[model samples]
Target: MLVRELLKNFQELANKEVEFTGRIRSNRQGKNVSFLVLNDGSVIDDVQVVYKNETKNFEQLSKQRLGAVVYIQGKLVPTPNRPQPFEIQAKISEIISECAEEYPLQKKEQSLEFLREIPQLRPRTKTFQAVFKIRSLLSFAIHKFFNEKDFVYVNTPIITENDAEGAGEAFVVTTRNDGKYEDDFFGKKANLTVSGQLNAEAYAQSLNSVYTFGPTFRAENSNTSRHAAEFWMIEPEVALNSLKENIDLIEELIKSVLSYVLENGRKELEACQNFFDDKLISRLESAKDSKFKVLDYAEAINILKEAVKKNKNEFEEKNIKFGLDLGSEHEKYLCEKHFGSPVFLINYPKEIKAFYMKLNDDKKTVAAVDLLVPGIGELVGGSQREDNFDKLILRSKELGINFDDLSWYFNLRKFGYYKSSGFGLGFERLVMYVTGATNIRDVISFPRTPNNLLF
Candidate 1:
């Protein structure tokens, strides 16, 4: 399996002979000469193969289909003066596999919607090739970021009886008969976890700095582009950390991740630039230099009210007083007009947030934060957990949650107490930020959105 990276060999080859196998992306035949474009995933660009009468398979290669695979032995030579830098002067060539005339992918453009239908074959196309490559590079960058910072990577449980996010909607993990769960998991009732905050918090208390990067499930019925039944979350928790410290760590983490992807995956970024506003890369780079704007819930309300007065809000107001959940529309308006980039909306009203959040001095707001990007509304959501036993139990009761199911979690606060703060960064949303991808479905390989499970 000899493979060559065409770009790596920039210098003119001095009668260098090489043997390689690759797919024929394009083909052309002249009176006495034939040319074939070949690529083997070793590089994004294809190398040109020039075959002459010295090869008996010239006729076979000339009649090959567009996507057929072929093997060629050739001497690399400079193009002399042409569009390409070099060309392969083939001494011998043979057809490895025939791609029949019915091959779906031609050398023409296809709509993303149409391409989505052929998920199994989309990678052969240039756009998806770049997208998936960027996806791999970004995942590596995320792991590298935490591993270098001494954050222990923790694998949290996927099936549980608990809803860690307290969102009340989770897909039940059951082996049932006709949707009846009486025979599932010993009839104990289990569901896929929506968040790993509680489990990750336990580890952070011991490991000091820990994180979980895994798939999380939610059964919410909202069929929006941002909502998904299954998605990847990057949750990082730190011990003895204040709310302000949590904000600082998040800003640093996001900036570092963006910088890594931008530097390592520039080609993919450029390939998909037309999908977003032209200022996408520059906007991200500018965020690295600018300070993140931090505002409390009250301050945010004030800003919104001011915007409303000035008619800056283009959409309908949802009675967004102080204690309401901000929708995606409101969030985008805030970041786009008020903040100009990434903003940390912190100290949310405790009654609206989860029970585990630490109570602030105001007794009304919790130590919570949601990082809102300009295009994507909420990129990361996190908070400092309440370490006090009595307060935690009281908050749990206030939220009408069954304390018996969470006895083990409370035991941590009862015995060994340590303050911890963490946040869940939506992995797909991060990709959307880096690539300017609009829908969450486009970023994930096979998105499990509502009513769409064809894959």
Candidate 2:
């Protein structure tokens, strides 16, 4: 039976016979009766079992190891004197699976770094339970938001012939022996795609409205908390949209996702309130109703310059000029210190951004936006694409990208191009923002970090 069903029956079935099979959380003693907290991994709290009389096994059941699984036949009775509503008076208790006493997860709190060593068992902890619950809720919210808006869910290829980001940050796929290298499928090289923007663009033009929510691989070896080699991204592309409309869609998409999680995952949020900043739900709720502050790269540069002039920055930002990629410190200053929340930095330098971004009339900047939040510096990167085929080809050639392989992408423009926009939001980063878990490694069930591929 589901734990929820068991909970609903707790009051109605009080003083009645009950049977349950679950894992034991803790076993201890009282004056006469022994207590055991049991859970099936379905609910956050455990069902308390009280053992009063039996054979030598009754004492043994009371002393069962922490991670041991057990079964019990008992009577449910109201505990008016206790904190919880009910407790199970067990007539017989049977041990199922006996675990070694050296289980890593003691009842005490373990550091996140220690949990990283045992990724397989980390999800069993209270903190990870909350993180994953929020993650699941946000995922459903993404699908629901797009589904309601009449957007088609498109599955773009994981292995592809094109490097859509044009930054050469993809992990090449190969099936070769130690002595030599073999060709990829169709005798052409392939790699895990860094972004599905190019593929999603084709589908968006045909499907009119589409989004791709899937794993995107990047070979960027930056070992920051936000940078994961393999991360899930949510990219939504829409046809016949201006930059302002695209920004509006982004704002709405983020707000809707956060709102869904806050509304539906309240229990998990309460469990995780200690790990994050004090006002997580309030922050998300505020964001839902609050308008995002927008600033251009040039304006942000001026803000940074003024900070430098006044010696307000914590460290020297010698190279942080107009066109430089905003460092983590700079991004934090813009969103946390100055703007005080999530802020959008728009119209970045064309040379620094991806190739597909549309070049503005100034010819030096692209219509791009990077969503910067308080803790997670860069949660999203997206932009409107260049609709003009000639401009796209010129940009690609100038950037030394092989345009011949991207014929289908170019063909989208050939068949009458329309202005469209898309962006990529890191799934783990969003989880960090919601759960207040500081590390990305803790949010994922099995985190895949560089040189550390443990089960």
Candidate 3:
């Protein structure tokens, strides 16, 4: 029987014989009996197993090392007024496998940095057991949210020719001995895709709604606590949606995911609260019910400028002005300090935003928005796409982009154009927000950072 099932059905399974196999978390040997705490990774809690010297295989079982796997056939008996509700009274027990004393995971507190060195074994720890469980559930909730909204799941290619962001941060896909395009795999220059929005757009134009969840690569060298060499992104595109509708979708998505995790993942969240941040649960709970604020990019810049004037040395990069990109510090001050909630910073300068965003009537700003939260700076970035073919071509040429390479993308507007909008949310950042794991490396089971890729 699975430990989780046995525990959940304890009242029904009381006084009945059940067999379970799990790794020993802790073991204590007494003069006539032994106690074992076993975990099978099905749930957050472990089941206790009681064995005596008279039980079968007592000699071998009692001498088994920590982390050893064992099978116990026993009856469930109530443990009145204790932490654990029930324990197994062993009728027959045997050691399935033996672990040497050199087992890396000891029953002691280990630093997160130390655990990073042992990613292979870290999942067995209580903290990771909770974190990854929540991660799995949240990922499911994402699919469920989109599926319920009548969105089709599209599996876009991992390799492509167009730089969607046009930031030149793509990891080039090249295998030719002489670096010649004719000898490459696709017979043209290609790179690991940075975003699936363009491909999702293709499916959206046909299906009216589509989303892509997949791995994305960035070749940037900044090794910050938030930056990773590779990450997962959720990009959804819909036809005939304006910038306001896109923001509404983003807000709904955040609240829905948070509510699902809070309700279905209560145990995991509680465990995380006890181990990591004390405010993890409260932050999530408040976020789900809070009224999200919306502020234009120009107004946000004015607030930052006034902030700098009042207090010198407020921000690290303190020169606050319009048309300048908002740094993480500026994002935090606006969300945490000013609004005390999530804020949508919109209508950024055309020069700073991507070429695909729709241009406003002022001809200087684009309908781009970034969802900024308290602790995490930017959680989601989205925009109303440029639907006009000629205007898109103009912006592409102005950005010094070779228009021919993106003709396939612009052809969507050429053949038939429709109003559309989409957004990209970093999966790991969402995990960090939910789990309260500070560093990007801690949330990722096997993080891939600059010069640091380990299993």
lDDT of each: 0.84, 0.83, 0.91
* CA displacement after TM-score superposition, residue 125 of candidate 1 (Å): 1.9
Runs with alpha carbons beyond 4 Å of true place in candidate 2: 55-57, 80-82, 177-183
> Could you give candidate 3's per-residue lDDT for residues 357-410 as a string of tens digits?
999999999999999987788999999999998899999999998978888898
Clashing pairs in 1: none
Cα-based RMSD of candidate 2: 2.0
| lDDT comparison, 1 vs 2, better candidate | 1
Q: How many clashing pairs per prediction, in order? A: 0, 0, 0
lDDT of 2 by residue, 138-170 (tens): 999989999999999999999988888777888
Winner by TM-score between candidate 3 and candidate 2 = 3
- Summing lDDT over every window of 10 consecutive residues in candidate 3, give the lowest-scoring window: 176-185
lDDT of 1 by residue, 1-455 (tens): 33445556647354688778888889988888788898887655678988987775777888998779999988888775987778888988888999989888888877778877777777776666677777788789889999999999999999888998777899977777566666676577788989888899888888999999999999998878788899999999999998988999999999888888789777677776755557777887888778889888799888787777777445586465988788888899888887798999999999888999999998999999999998898999999989999999999988888888889898899778789898999988988888777777777777787788998
Ranking by lDDT: 3, 1, 2
